[model samples]
Target: MRQKTQRRWRILRRIDAESRALAETLGIHPVSACVLLNRNLTEPAALQHFLNPSLESLHDPYLMKDMDKAVARLRQAIDGQERVMIHGDYDVDGVAATAMMVRMLSALGVDVTHHIPHRVDEGYGVSAEGIRQAAANGVKLVVTVDCGISAYEEALLARELGLDLIITDHHQPPPAFESQIAYFGAAVAVLNPNRPDCGYPFKGLCGCGVAYKLATALVENLGHPGNALQRAYLDLTALATIADIVPLRDENRAIAQFGLERLSDTKKPGLKALMGVCGIAGKRLSSYHVGFVLGPRLNAAGRLDTAETALNLLLTRDDSEAGRLADALNQLNRERQEEESSTLQDAELMIESGADALGGDILLDSDKALVLASEDWHMGVVGIVASRLAERYVRPTILITMGEDEGKGSGRSIRAFDLKKGLDGCADYLVGYGGHAQAAGLTVTRGQLSQFRARFLQVADEQLGADDLIPVVDIDCELGPRDLTFELVNELRRFEPYGHENPGPVFAIRGAKLLDQCTVGANGKHLKLRVGFWEASYDALWWRKGDNFGRFSRHQLLDLCFSLDINEYQGIPSMQFVVKDVQPS
Candidate 1:
């Protein structure tokens, strides 16, 4: 069966005068300038910076709130030769962040160790048991990377155990009380951009980005070559930044831009081995490689096994050990994929069943939200399943793994809905919850699952409008077939390292005729087409869209939304179009 397209297409409107002015001043095509303008790069300096992000454009690390304090404490620990513990989360961001901090400290001649919480056992953040263990191990200082922003109780516990705590995280802090002066109660320093009081210019850094800032400041304060050390750790920072799905703008853009360059020739044996195993070594890397290939491999260790496996891979200097760990992680990733596919299938089957089977939950009635639960679902893969479900259904989706008494839930939301806020509205049913606007995690008691599901659905229904349900195809600008030149495509390369806020441009072509088309790929799941207007024609690849092959005939007029790409075959690079959506004219 063919799936129908349910997206609303809107071409971005641009002021002709502004486009003309920008094009003339920047000495570029009007369409390119219009795309920049659409991204809010209007000011001359801003446009220049956006096009050519420089390493110097990165803000000073000291500007972050508590930077000086965190640095001073860390320097003292280093000077005193005290034992320090790096506490990190279990995901890719946390693993990279932990590795970055550990390496920086080790280079500074400090006695440092690291701890990554077990995904199913310890849960997220700095756990009380972990801090107690650190204290038992004679650790005088504990710096948490990628987590601990919401560890109010754990912070207090650290204080009680006489362990100094420094929290470096990017996740939203727990709500502060009106009378409370700071969010992380007993921690010596908390470095997070999301804190309301912090005045750091850019607030979009991921957890690893925050950890990198701390590392940068610590390296510089100790009279070391800060930039040199920063360069060494850029691969790790970039890996986490991309994997964590942070916005690639401002300092982040510079970090990813330079990091990708550095990652191409990474000297770290673990990363080199990982790249080799993933079959991306020696290739020019991009956010795509980090986000898809390497990130998942690193994350798989934490998901199915211990995060320490990934951390050890990052810290190991032995080539043989690195290869073994890389092989193990690759195996774990394969296992993770299998679990994800099985869980996704089970979730879809549950959805296909009727509401009566789900105890008449409101989620079944409104279809505005989905709250799927199963005792058999693996917790690590539920988030991926939730993301897929949200994208497919065009609504917020929560997948929960039911335990004996409580259930752990992960949620993904459509653009119009704020998942964190939705969870907040249903807080009465949740034991605890946290996350950002688009994604979140929660814990709900098995007894209250029905109530939470109904309440979450109500929140989605009340908040989401009918228009918000339809997916949107936001065209950057309209381009004629004549504009599909190699020069213009090369100029577009200036907008590199696209992610989150800074997206690759999408252009629409009107009244194009399909010259030839065919179903391709395994299972004929891709549509390969030659489309053109007048005398100009280009090859187009529509992925997973072969079901629509029957809708088109040769010489049929169609409107196309697509992104320009460069496809290389036998060392010859040629222009190709990635078809996003096609409709009859």
Candidate 2:
């Protein structure tokens, strides 16, 4: 289906003869081989690991920087019976990481508790208040999960309070601190693969992935089996790994694959209850289920209320408590949906009424980035709005909720722009900021709102070009209607748990006849069509495109790009197309 805004479709080059041979050698389809080759997985070992992920695929946890030190400190805490508090962020990644650390440490008989900060109150990263509370509770050690990379002050505070601090995070660190472990935020150990000096082979671990590493190291250090403990933590690692939107390759992919398998029959009462509430219990789960279905519900706790609720859900062993917590999360998710839609509508209205737009009111015209702020905006939901705006407008988008004297904003960016690095360029305007390249959070004084917007847009203009602004739909391969078969679909299933860099393969078919069309679903918001290639006909669904129902006619010849899918109804399975884009021939 065509829209006013045309997305750039880039088809990857077809695989060569050698790749076809590799496919034969691997006993897989050429399409699967092409997808693997597109990701530059030409080596035999990498291909085998990807095809059949196993415990051997995971790297040694000791490879991460400061892992040994972190493990030793944890041993001391265990042997001496020292009190420990785990400091974690409020998002899905943070909560999962926290839950994993707390559970694993408790299993090892360490005196451990966790603190998940309130989003609106404590904001992101390690908070000084949390450290103070831990000290007040006589906690002698503080371990952070999914946060503390930029907590120089908080780390120092922990030290002054006579508490040993260990920082476990995966966010990009300050450039100057890459080689200088001595300045690792005054913490005894900082375990982040992104650290330049760290020799970890894979650098795309999420917060929970790093925390899992520490857990495994501790298990092996304490003279227990590593793989068994690793398996024990995969469910949480998988949840955070997918939720955090890290690259799904290397060890991250293995964790996701194995984790989804474990999540299917999770023994955790909280996870089981959550899956029941989400209506996904006893079903084969995928990355889609984790990232879209479960992640948001877990995230809703933090976005609308306290993330402690979600953390509590994960930690709870009692079935009744899990049921109550899951129900609470479900309700919070509904509220979150309403708030997100309301905030998104407000941002859209602001853009539509250009007068309300900051930075000289050039939002829809010359501006390369979107910087929107409003006192009426909810601080917790602005990040979701920023994500929608960034994806819809194909620009780096920042949505801020203005406070009395300052504003807290979340920014999401496209491939062309590195959001954290861009924020680094605007450091003069920001009060503080920390996050990944694609997503980040920041603080700015109300006075500097306009200046920060202008500078941010300027940086974007310098970095992005006209082509970079266009969203690219990367087509992995082009195939005929006859190529769509159960075998091919099964092969595609092998690439499950896809996210970020390893998205589901997109396929393109040229000159398919549009046989019939109609709007389906509630409010007639979805487009359903009968698409055919010669005598081969298949049902296709174009979600959220009912507005274009009358745009095409019967027997129309069109080029369609879609992902192949299977629809099962009444114990019958058939091939179908999940349409992406359509163009007239």
Candidate 3:
């Protein structure tokens, strides 16, 4: 029987000989060495650093471009006792950055107020209204985190209002078509690795990571102990680093590595309460917990309510207050999930009813992309829905909420397509747009939506090839049931803090006999399988693959691609196979 969805398996070329040599020298398993080699960590020093990251491995904070200027301005503000305002975005990175800045400044005995813009009302970045409010409050200096590089008008507005502006962001600078040097407009200092003039060695720091660097520099210049601050705040940096979806390599890997260790003992009342609410308290934290468990709860306030709720939670000192705020965020996350599910259903319906519909299978359509809009959809969750649609249909997707005169929306794209460039090509139909290559947001007048949709689809069709539509699973190596041992799985744990550019290694297994299969989970949304190879049997869990349970029978031979992990139950730990894909042998 054929599977409902098609997947492409691209097995990585094995470096078995190199792995054996490296393993002997490094005192590790060949499989672990192979995974490291696959990630291009061939050098001994790089491998050792990756295996055991340390705080000393972090780069100097002053190495970034504009560091001196930003530090000087902040020092002046602190020395003069000027009222400073930290303007932040509404996402997790923004929330974490805002919290870090507020705490860092407060520790220096400087008066700092923060403003997190409402997602619906203020959109993103530094807004003129936010600046005007800061001015009205007699703010002398304004610092932005996670946003502001593209705030050309807002930066000018700060100048007009006689307020100094410092932008600490990780987003790419505004595109410069004609000039060789990137223009950051009129900010006092722009601290961003993506800036053309920036000499930061690692360009993948998240917004909070940049904020952490700024805070570190400020603390050192103030004659305060810097190590204590870094240790105290790395949990926030790690949370933002994972949540921002930035590549986890170089400095980012070190931050995440140290941050995960710090998270289990985080002193923040808010983080403790959040972990408790998420049922992750007292456990060894990882990037997975930050990205999937904690990140969404922090993001819920920004998505469903005002971001200030989340920012306040992080800034609060009272334990009871933290508990209350955590509860509120938990409830909001539930609401967000419901809204996302509903919106996704509506999007699927639209695809099925549209001209490009194909036999009830969204992925079997001729359309290069899916652009959907609904006045009834919630604006906050459209981005997540767009991502879900893009993954399911294997095409770039945009979901919009139509307003009276304008349509606001977000988009998600596959690897072969660059959404930012696609939007650039259709700039005429858009009122405004901003974001990265894989995701973006746009606004257009209702009258221009049809044209924007058509233009976007045209761009995707021109750029995407047939192979681009098929999802590719890159297998690190082929393995057998006999190799699935607790020791090997434990060694794989060195690749902790996996995300973005560094994912958990996937392995392929050939000709395994299906010993047993059954549906599990609350709604039978998952599958539990027993497979045997040679004389060894293993337990496998297939998430969201329960619909295919009937396709396999006892003694059926199958090929599988999976990742290895340790699953614990009733005080017992054992190796578990997480199935990625399966096919008949």
- lDDT to native, each model: 0.87, 0.87, 0.86
Descending-lDDT candidate ranking: 2, 1, 3
Q: How many residue pairs clash in each candidate?
A: 0, 1, 0
**Candidate 3 wrong stretches, greater than 4 Å:** 1-4, 177-185, 355-364
Give per-residue CA lDDT, model 1, range 1-585, as digits (tens): 124347789889553888888889889988898889888988778877888899888999988999999999998897899999999999999999999999988887899998999988888778878999999999999999999887878888888889899999998876652234443457889899888889999999999999999988887887788679767999899888889999998999999989889888888999999999999999988788988899999998887889998999999999999999999999999999999999988887777674422354434445688888888888998899999988877889899888899988899999999999888899999999999999999999989999898888889889998778778989988987778888888888888887888888899888988899999997898999998777777899999889878789899998889999898899998888899999888
Better-scoring candidate (lDDT), 2 or 3: 2
- What C-alpha lDDT, on a 0 to 100 scale, does residue 284 get in candidate 1? 84
lDDT of 3 by residue, 1-585 (tens): 122357888878565787899989988888888788888998868877888887888889889988999999999998899999999999999999999999989888889998988888888788788999999999999999999877777887898889999999988775751152223446778899888877888899999999999999988898878788878798889989989999888889988888888888999999999999999999999888988899998998999889988898888999999999999999999999999988888777777666321122223367788888888888999999999888887889888888889978899999989899889999989998988999998998988877887788788889998888888889998876667888988888878889988899999989989999999997899999999877778889999888888888889999999999888899898777899999898
TM-score of 3: 0.96
| Model 2 clashes, total count | 1
Per-model TM values vs. the true structure: 0.96, 0.96, 0.96
Model 2, 462-534: lDDT tens digits are 9999888788888988887667889999888988878988888888888889899999998899999998887
- Where is model 2 poorest over a 10-residue stretch in terms of lDDT? 355-364
RMSD of every prediction:
2.0, 1.9, 2.6
